[model samples]
Structures are given as C-alpha cells and as structure tokens.
Target: PRFKSKKATRQGFKTDRAKIIKGKLRLDKPHGIKNWYDIRMSGDKLLTGELKVVSICRENGKYWASLPFEIEVANKAKTNRVTAVDVNVGHINYTEGKINTLPDNLKRSYKRIKHYQRMLARKSVINGKRATKSNNYVKTRAKLQRDYRKVANIQHDIMQKFTTQLVEEYDKIVIEDLQVKQMQMTHVAPKGLQRSMFGYFRQILSYKCDWNGKKLILADKYYPSTQRCSKCGHIKTGADKVGLNGNLKHGTKHNEYICYECGSVMDRDENAVYNLLALIN
Candidate 1:
C-alpha cells in the first residue's frame, strides 16, 4: 500500500529478511545503510500478483515508489443523473438543465493575492538598484512566494470540493473542452486565469467518475456555450445585447458577463455557468 525507498531496501540487502506480511513486502528491521534501495532488477522471471511494486519515480524533488494492486471492480448499475458544468472567471455554474452557481471563496483570496503580487513587484523594482541579496529583498520575495502558494492551495481545495460534489451527485457530466492554451497566447485574460482550470477539473472528474462507475462527456471546444441563448436556442450574433460587447455595455467588469436574451444579469462567471447548464439538456 506504500512505497519504500530503493536505497533503504538495498542497504540492508536482506533477501532472507523479506517477509510478505499483510500482502506487502516488509523488512524485519531497518538496514543501517543508504543507497541500497536504488537497485532494480529486470527479467522475465518477475513475479506477477495482485500486489506488486510497479515502478519508482523521482518527481518534484522527491522520490516515489509506485505499487499496482488489483482489486475487484465494483458492479453498480449505471445512473441517469446528468449535469453540465461551466468554468468561468469568477464562479462555477452547474445544472441538470437548471441554473445553480457554486459559491467560490477562492476568488476573494485570488484578489488579495493579486494585490500582494503587485505590491511585491513594485517593491522589488524600487529596491533592485540597492542589492540582490538584501534582507529586505529576500523577505519580500519570500512573502510573495508564500502568498502565491496560499492562493494556489485555496484554488486546489475549492476545485477538489466542487468537483467531488459534482461527481458524487451526477452520473454523466458534460463540460466544454475550452481552448485555454490558445486563449493564453492571445493574452485575452489574466495569465493565471488562462492557465486552464478546466484541465484540473477534468482530471479530478475523470478518475472520480471511473471509480464511481459514471460517465463524463466533453462537448466541442468551439461550441457556442456563450453566444447561444439557452432558453430559446437563438444563435446570438454580434454584441448588440447578447455577446461580450453587450455585456460590457451593461456595466459588467472584466471577467464578468450578463445575458440580455433572458434578462438574467449575473456575474459573468454565473452567466457562463447558466449557459453550460443549457447545453446539457
């Protein structure tokens, strides 16, 4: 169930001490040596079993051992519960063909972190001529990094909770496969925003659905989730009152959107969520 260090395994070099306890290889005692676990064997004689060490990996400044264990895949009747999720600038909207927006606390945290980043950038530039390794510079940089990490953690936590809720509630989830990479190249939105939260959401949803015996449907990337009126199926053209330009005229801030077709004006993010819900049904 857990990976032990290759170095740890090799230092002891106790093949006889190895015992299969609880279906796992465990050593009777710690080997008083290092780098012994780094050894690997490759051959056709490798044993095959439900519990096996698959591979070892070094990633993100850490080493990991991978174990693949086979368990009986549960048999559950497929479900008909379907929902569509929309990821927008400010909030996540989801629906079973009905409007519902998930409250996102990360937006507030992001705004605060953005403010801190700007302040840090300004301070760094102002103090750049003085010194590189100055205490003030190092302290400021550390603070900035801490703030950034906090923001990232908040975003991850929120997304996990949101995605978990959706996977648990719905059997089939539909979402637009957004062209976030292209959008980043265009510089149409903040770099942080364009970094593709959809990928993370999709990843979490995919595994959760698979484990729960559900289905996930990806809509076309270019699907007009925003332009088409969900209520009447009206293909909205131009910015008169339905598109981005219309939303700007309606006093929506950047990253905010409103739909004139349904007179349902909300935070631009909520608007995108509503549009996504429409696509599901």
Candidate 2:
C-alpha cells in the first residue's frame, strides 16, 4: 500500500485500542487537547456491541468517526420463501414481477455532482496542467467533494434498503453470476451497468443473506439466462439471443424474448429472472 499523504483531502487513522466510555470515544494516545471526543452517531445500537475498531477521518471539512463492533445475530426463521432477481441496466427485475429502481433524487444528485466536477476542473486547470490551488479553486474542490459524498450516501442508502428487503422477504435468493468485467470490455451497456453497481449489489446481498440465515444461489456465469426462454427452457441463438453475437444485433428490438419452440413470449429481463429462479426451485 502507498504511504498515507498529509496533503490528501480525506485522511484518517484506524486503531483497535480506542475505547468507548459513557457514550464518548477515547483514544489511547491523546493527540488533541483531550483524549475523548463526543461523537454524534446515528443510533445508540452501535454502542451496544463489542467495539472492535475505531476509525476517525476528516473529509470535505467535516470530521467523522466510524466505530465497528461485533455482535451476535439470531438467524431468521425459515419461511421456505424463494425468489430470483435479474440486475438489468435500468432496473432490477424479480420473480414476483416487481421492479425496483433508484429514486429520481439520485439522478438529480448525479447531475449536481457532475456540474460541480466541471466547475472544479475549470478552477484548478491552467495551461494544460493542474496549478496550485487558489482560494476559489479550493472552494470549488470542496464543493465537488461534498457532492461526491452526497452521491455515495445516496447509493449506500438505496443499497441497504433494497438488499435488506430481499433478505427479509425470501428464504432463498437466486441471482446470476454476471461477468461484469467481460461485459464492460465487450461494450455492453457500459454506462448503465456502471451506474447500476451490479457487483456491489451482489456483495451486499451476499453478506446480508449470510447474516439473515437466507440462502443465496449464484447461477453459472455462462448459463445464458438472458438468452433462454423461461417458459419452455428453450435457448435462443443468432438473432434471437439478447446480446451481441458475431457483430449482429441480437434479440427482438422491443426487448421481448420470444421462444420459437413453444411460442412463449416475455420481457427479456423478466425471462432471465425466471430462468435463474428455476436453478434451485
């Protein structure tokens, strides 16, 4: 790992020696005037567990403390409920015919972040090189970082809610093992897929499932979930496939999957979700 730089806008140190005493965080070594700092945390539940590590960081002119703890979690009772989900470029399709998407506020946040980023660049760049920071440049950079934090928090909130809901509602959850890197390299829905955060979604779902005593099944990466007909188990080929095949635009233009073998018609993403559901049904 690279050495930590003092010039970095975001800086922090982690230590296991930190102790929590009467709702205050106290470090073993006193760096500031006092060893203990009164931290404003979101909930008191974090204080209940065995504190393991404390991380203090400063970013965007704000100081934050993160206290990670260990606790026992009782596994949820089994309900025998099962579900499958397909992560699409635009939305997530599930076996229950429910589509979940990020709210419009996230899009607005992205736009604001982009605007700040452009402004920051103009303020910092000079003669094709990044010049020394001026008062205005630093102010713009801080605004950009604030927007970055906003976007991150927004995504984190949505991810937590969506993943928690899935773990709560289903005993067994099935999802395709998507080859995200290969998809990106092949230029398949690049922008949309990146924004979708599919890999991170899977990561969150996996841990949440483990904590909730839910079973998470990963369908094979090359299982052709998107190209197979969920109704008749017929796999499409050539122009019928939902993705690129030998430079030919495959699948129906309307994003519908039609199985010639059984004449079963369905939305492409919904069909994939069902096909994944069939894996462990």
* Candidate 2 structure quality by residue, lDDT tens digits, 125-235: 652344434666667777778877876787778778888888888899999898888777765567667777889999999998989889999998889888888888888
Candidate 2: residue pairs that collide: none
Q: Which candidate is the best by lDDT?
A: 2
TM-scores, all models, native as reference: 0.58, 0.87
> Model 1, 267: alpha-carbon shift in Å?
8.8
For candidate 2, the lDDT comes to 0.76
lDDT of 1 at 147: 56
Poorly placed runs, candidate 1 (over 4 Å):
1-79, 96-130, 248-281
Per-candidate local distance difference test = 0.58, 0.76
